[model samples]
Target: MTYCKVCSLGSDHPGIVVDEQRVCNVCRLDMVGDLLVNYRYTQEVFERFQHAGRNELGPYDCLFMYSGGKDSTYMLDKFTTEYGKRVLAWTFDVPFESTHAAENIRLAKERIPATFVVDADDDNIKKMMREVFNRPAPRKPGKYLDEKLPCVSCRTFFVIRAILHAHRNRIPYIALCADPQQILTMESNVREIVRGFYTTFGVGLTDELFRGEIEGLLFAEDDELPEIVFPFIAMRHTYDPDAIVAELKAKGLYASSPMETHCTLFPLLNYYSFTHWDCMFYKLNASSHVRAVKRNGGDGARSTFSLKFPGTLDVLEVEGRLKKVTLRIAKGEGTPQEHEAELVAAFRDLGTTETAARFVARSFLDMPAVAADMGIRLS
Candidate 1:
């Protein structure tokens, strides 16, 4: 029962069977080179993509998902100063966002003076996160179980809330402040967008998550909203992340004081994405010169699920989180050494025992290729 990973279709689907196991429809439809070939845009069409997106105005122009990070600050600057569009900045504060991130958001509110909204239910959110991580998932399926893949569940929740917020507010476009390197313009299509959503652990689309019942009950009575647009798809080519930061800083848009991501899990989750996607692929390719530096002896690897680099966190935080749930589930909180032994035993049961033993061989080798293949990377 070999299945094709690409389309998630099986050999039963019409396709040229590859290795007599699985075959992708797209691959069957065309030869390897045919699919891989890139079409050069014409001079006019290429030039068409050069300009900023059309200035579309309605009751409200856009909704900016502001994390008060340097990137989002720059985006807010561009939307207000450069484009002169009235935008709504929406911030989602999950239970786990760091203290610094919260400060950053407050700073943005003071400086920007834009209409801002914050949505969160702290205790419930934390319970959900704990449940998500503590619930045992099989290592074989490889859904979102990369070792120490921090805060994935929370991020997904925030995105869903953001989407619902945008729709209810009647905002036409949603700006993520995501750099060009994080996601590409071609990936803006519906299918790629959905795939990206899944890769980021947004498994339940809103249509299902809400179950056809709007929570607020007010939005259901209001205007009809169908879709939300990612303005980064158009702006990525025009704006630079570093330059955006610099320009905003010049306008007294300093980094926020109570800054944190939308999730408590970012400090750990970002470790993989920042290194692999940003530093290794994007920076090395010269897409952007944001050199990722692991200043505090951190993991310089990337996340396979949502390819991005990691971020700063106290070593105690990382060790504490990893040893808290994974070890506790394995050892029942006996002792530090006992927890380590139990974790090793659990990994062995999952056929990752060798890698766990190697981690014991070297203190910092906690995550190995087996776990890396699950999504984490160590290099």
Candidate 2:
């Protein structure tokens, strides 16, 4: 398959358009004059917000989401040392988080002088995740659902929890460390959206329970809320992931390589998406990494971080083969049962325990129902 020379986005991917110059539509859009102007305006606004909120009476200037990954660690250092902000660093302790990540958190707490808090509501979080996994697939699954539903829902939960904490403590700002490719702006109707999600998922919430738990957690219609900001996008310099990792290691903030810091469930979820939909959940993010490296005058292919499975398997190589298999299956050259067997093999290769694999596999057993809900054929 052909790929854009600039971003390495494949021509075969849905909604991607490549030009004669071997550049992708995203690159073309990036060249637009107004878009650049708007980006500058966003930076200016963020600066103004930071300056104005510096003298607020709250104990902390910002509530920073700290995952102990390279990106978050870098941002925490900047907030505390560079910007001189009084920060409250909050970590959501997910059950499947890597041991390396936990160690990184311990190191960062020792190195960075910030009020550190780790939220561990395992029972409630597990219950919510069970509902997320078992709920019927969406009628109109938006882009990235097959790969990102669990991550996105979990993020939403934590973001809401962060907002509630910030509001109660009178913190004026909430800072997130998502890279430019993954950043999303807070919408005005976020409250409504959160309520809709809980109702739709029936997330262990009766009417009275929702009123007691959700209503109190959410802000009123006219209540002032903490302003949400993406620090990576607002910063002036390009976000070099490699540089960030190197700096973190040099400062004794983190010890592991980037590939070793993700959630344990990440590989399993990516395997599921690739087998079921012929799409790598991380394909776009990987492409974005390549583009960013090239923009910084680095070799895109050589500098790009490749996803690693538990064993010796390289994820990108697997993606190429999966794409071909998907095409063959579409043209009646492959069998669904063969694909199912391949998925089982892939799970085994990931080194998952038999019981864990079976449990997660059962969660997606209604793929046909999910496909029907989305008005598509799985095979």
Candidate 3:
């Protein structure tokens, strides 16, 4: 049960390799030469694009994705004030968004000078999620599902929708405020990948719906495409969540801490991932937090990073309950139905509808086999 002294990755965690010095492979990689050189290149490219975008004759310099969470709110402010860009702050109003996030959007609208837009295509979004959940499990489900298909697919929806808006409106750049770890390079083949996602996962969608919205847009010429930029990575911003919240509050911009704001389905997703894969989606970010703390000359031991649940769930309490459930299942101390009933109850308590909670609880029928594929034993 040894753990990395730096990132705190336990030896039992899937695929984790800790050396004798009690440091995990991820932490060790950080010590190697020039880890962020690619990010530096991305920053340079972003600056060039920003300059070009400003010089262009367009109504908006960037279509900033404003989730009203701490990071997005801070980045929205920075884009408007620090960068002095003519920003179009766009919020994709997903049905599962936290109530507090909605309030934050209202506050940001009053404080920020950007032109704000909320696109609430609730029906389509719900339809997409239902398709994602109802799709047959892949034959060889791997750790990829641990990332949560619903979350990833929904974000893909956001990206596609943003691209459509920016392209049609002739916005030169589309800005996203994803943290450094989540920042992905918009490579030349991105459109192909995006297209493949639709063809594969979006099979349930009608041809008319696909052709009307995605087909031609995805095939647009590279020159005509809006340049996608990640502001946090471009600026090499050190992401301190606590500082971000404080800064937003100082500006009279109402913002909730990460734990207090997210999609309502996040707790159920976390429970699903943890129960099946023995890991949470935030595991990678937790390690990143430790590295950031040590880089800033602070003790990694003192870092406050931990498994987080979205919305109003008390993280420590949830962790305790999850551990107990894990123990009971591993020891064969509870029947499968009893264990599922308990999880469904927990999800319901966390604000998910009882039907949705039960659906998630039952969704694990095939997960034991998937877990075995990844060399994880599920009891």
- Could you give the C-alpha RMSD of every candidate to the true structure, in order shown? 12.4, 8.2, 8.1
lDDT winner between candidates 2 and 3? 3
Q: Alpha-carbon error at 50 in model 1, in Å?
A: 12
Q: Judged by TM-score relative to the true structure, which candidate is superior, 1 or 2? A: 2
Off by over 4 Å in 1: 1-58, 141-152, 184-226, 234-241, 256-263, 267-379
TM-score quality measure for candidate 1: 0.49
User: In angstroms, what RMSD does candidate 1 have relative to the true structure?
Assistant: 12.4
Kindly state the number of residue pairs that clash in model 3. Answer: 0
1-379: candidate 2 lDDT, tens digit per residue? 5678876665555445678898887667643464455455456546755686463567898889888788899889988998888899999887767677899999988999999998766655555555555555433223334356666666776776777787778777778777654543222133654675575456555232223455654555433566666787664355566677778888989887655566655543443455443466666655665565667666443222222233233445555654554444434554666655554554444444454444333323333443344333343
Give the better candidate number (1 or 2) by lDDT: 2
| Clash totals, every prediction | 25, 0, 0
Q: Supply candidate 1's per-residue lDDT for 36.
A: 27
Instruction: List the candidate 3 regions with Cα displacement exceeding 4 Å.
Output: 1-41, 53-57, 134-145, 184-193, 199-212, 234-237, 290-298, 301-320, 323-379
The candidate with the higher TM-score, 2 or 3, is 3
What lDDT, from 0 to 1, does candidate 3 have? 0.63
Lowest-lDDT window of 10 residues in candidate 3?
A: 301-310
Poorest stretch of ten by lDDT in candidate 2: 302-311
Off by over 4 Å in 2: 1-45, 55-57, 136-141, 144-146, 184-213, 216-223, 289-316, 321-379
lDDT of 1 by residue, 10-111 (tens): 232222243454544433444334322311212222233334354343455666778766667766766776766677788876544545456667777787
